[model samples]
Target: MAYKITDECISCGACEADCPVGAISAGDDKYVIDADTCIDCGACAGTCPVGAPVEA
Candidate 1:
C-alpha cells in the first residue's frame, strides 16, 4: 500500500527528501504523497517529525 500524508504534517520537507521514489510533494496546505508513484518503502514515514505519513 501507498503512504498517505495526514493533516498533521508540518510541511517541513523532510519527508520529501526521504522518499526514494520522489512521490512526496508540497501541497497547498501540507506535503502530499502521490499514491501511484509511492513505493511503500516507509522512508518518508520514518523521517516525518509529526508522524504524518501512514499506510494507505
Candidate 2:
C-alpha cells in the first residue's frame, strides 16, 4: 500500500516536500498523493503537522 493524504491536510505543502518519490502534489482542497508513485516510506506522514498522511 502507498501513503495517502487525508482531508485533514491543511494544504501547508509540508508533506509534498517530504515525499522522497515526489508523489505528493497540491489539490483543490488538500495535498494529494500519487499512489503509483508513492514508495510508502512514511516520510510525508511524519512531516504532516495535522497528521493527514496515512497508509493506504
Candidate 3:
C-alpha cells in the first residue's frame, strides 16, 4: 500500500523532500501522496516530524 499524509501534517515539506520516489507533494492544507507513484518505501514517514505519513 502507498503512504498517505494525515491531517496531522504541518506542511513542513520534510516528507516531500524525503520521498525517494517523488510521490509526496504540497496540498491545500497538507502534504499528499500520489498513490500510483508511491513505492511504499516509508521515506516520508521516517522524515516527517509530526508522524503524518502513514500506510494506506
Candidate 4:
C-alpha cells in the first residue's frame, strides 16, 4: 500500500527529500503522497518526524 500524510503533518518537508520515488509533494494544508507514484517502500513514513505517513 502507498503511504498517506495525515493531519498531523507539520509541513516540515522532511519526508519530501527522503522519498526516493518522488511521490510526495506539498499540498495546501499539508504534504501529500502521490499514491500512483509511491512504491510502498515506507520511506516516507520512516522519514516523517510526526508519524504523519500511514499505510493506505
Candidate 5:
C-alpha cells in the first residue's frame, strides 16, 4: 500500500527529503505523496516527525 500524509503533518519537509523514490512533495497545507511513485518502503513515515505518513 501507498503511504498518505494525514492532517497530522506539520508541513515539515522531512518526509519529502527522506522519500527515496521522490514521491513526496509540499502541498498547500501539508506534504502529499504520489501513490504511483511510492515504493511503500515506509521511508516517509520513518522520517516524519509528526508521524503523519500512514499506510493506505
Candidate 6:
C-alpha cells in the first residue's frame, strides 16, 4: 500500500523534499501524498516531524 499524510501534518515541507518519488505536495491545510506515485518507500513518513505519514 502507498503512504498517506494524516491530518497531523504541519505543512513543514520536509516530506515534500524527502519524497523520492515526488508524491508529497502541499494541500489546503496540510500536505497530501499521491498514492499512485508513492513507491511505499516510507521516506515521507520518516521525514515527517509530526509523524503524519502512514501506510495506506
Q: After TM-score superposition, what is the CA distance of residue 56 in candidate 4 from its true location, in Å?
A: 0.7
Better of 4 and 5 by lDDT: 4
> Candidates' lDDT values, in order?
0.94, 0.90, 0.92, 0.94, 0.93, 0.90
Higher lDDT: candidate 5 or 6?
5
1-56 per-residue lDDT for model 1 (tens digits) = 99999999988999999888899999999999899999999999898889999999
Clashing pairs in 4: none
lDDT of 3 by residue, 1-56 (tens): 99899999999999999888888888898889999999999999899899999999
Clashing pairs in 5: none
lDDT for model 5 comes to 0.93
Better of 3 and 4 by TM-score: 3
TM-scores for every predicted model: 0.96, 0.95, 0.96, 0.96, 0.96, 0.95
Where model 1 places Cα greater than 4 Å from the true spot, the runs are none
RMSD in angstroms, all models?
A: 0.5, 0.6, 0.5, 0.5, 0.5, 0.6
Runs of candidate 4 exceeding 4 Å displacement: none
By summed lDDT, which 10 consecutive residues of candidate 3 come out lowest?
18-27
Residue 12 lDDT in model 5? 72
Better of 3 and 5 by lDDT: 5
After aligning candidate 3 to the native by TM-score, how far in Å is the CA of 52 from where it should be? 0.3
| Model 4 error, position 23 (Å) | 0.4
Give lDDT: candidate 4, residue 8: 99
Model 5 TM-score? 0.96
User: Could you tell me the TM-score of candidate 6?
Assistant: 0.95
